[model samples]
Structures are given as C-alpha cells and as structure tokens.
Target: MLITKGYFYNRESHVNCQALKDAWVTLLSRYHWDWFCTFTFRGEILHPEKASKTFDTLLCKINRALFGR
Candidate 1:
C-alpha cells in the first residue's frame, strides 16, 4: 500500500537498506502499518540483482497464489 500511496518509491524518500529496516521497525512498533512492509511490497519491482533469496520465496508464493500451481 505504501508504494501505491507514494511512500517508499519517492526519490525524496530514503528507501535504502538501513532506511527500509528502520521504517519496518517503526511500522512494526506502530502495528497498523505492517501491511506496507509485508503485503504492499512487490519483489518484482526490484532489480534482479537486488532481489534476495527471501524475495525468491515471496515471488514463488505470489506466483502460486495467482496461478494456483
């Protein structure tokens, strides 16, 4: 929801590794915003090199959810 809401992708916003971690921390602490980190994020939006193993797992899950395989 964050990306669609225009939060994480803004060039004005610092969405680097450390900044992302901190934002997740804040969202976890706040509770309501957890969906931004967990659900709203799309690994396919990241470059291939930047997609981690975890993202691979998520991508597989997304594929399964969409394709029913």
Candidate 2:
C-alpha cells in the first residue's frame, strides 16, 4: 500500500518527530504490508545522518527482513 505523510508534514511545525517516528515503527511492526513509501518536504533537518539512519536504513532493513534478499 502507498502510505504518505506529505500532507501532514507540509510544515515542520506541524510535526512531532519523536511521535511520528514511534508511530512509523509501531505501524510497521503491527502490519505486514507488501511495500511502502514515506516522504517529507524541504525543511531544516536537525541531524541529517541520524535521520537517514532512522528512516532510510530502517526501511531497507525492514524490506530485507521481510523479503530475505
């Protein structure tokens, strides 16, 4: 399924980073969706490398764990 948070993330002020991160982890753990995607618009990233590790690397890890490839 195609899940997106672009609308909700239109502005950084509208987001709670920790809560959003927790939600993503919780939902992903609770559901076995075939595939997914996430995004955010231009904004000041507090920690770019850490954000990548949390999102990009985590997604890749999930995909690998599920698909075994």
- CA lDDT of each prediction against the hidden true structure: 0.63, 0.68
Model 2 TM-score on a 0 to 1 scale: 0.30
Find the candidate with the highest TM-score and give its number.
Answer: 2
TM-score of each: 0.27, 0.30
Residue-level lDDT of model 1, residues 2-35, one tens digit each, is: 4643245655653555667787798779655434
Candidate 1: Cα lDDT at 9:
62
Clashing pairs in 2: none
Per-residue C-alpha lDDT of model 2 across residues 1-54, encoded as one tens digit per residue: 222563235433455566777898998798788967776635766477767766
Q: How far is candidate 2 from the true structure (C-alpha RMSD, Å)?
A: 12.4
In model 1, the clashing pairs are none
Give the Å error, residue 32, model 2.
16
Alpha-carbon RMSD to native, per candidate: 11.7, 12.4
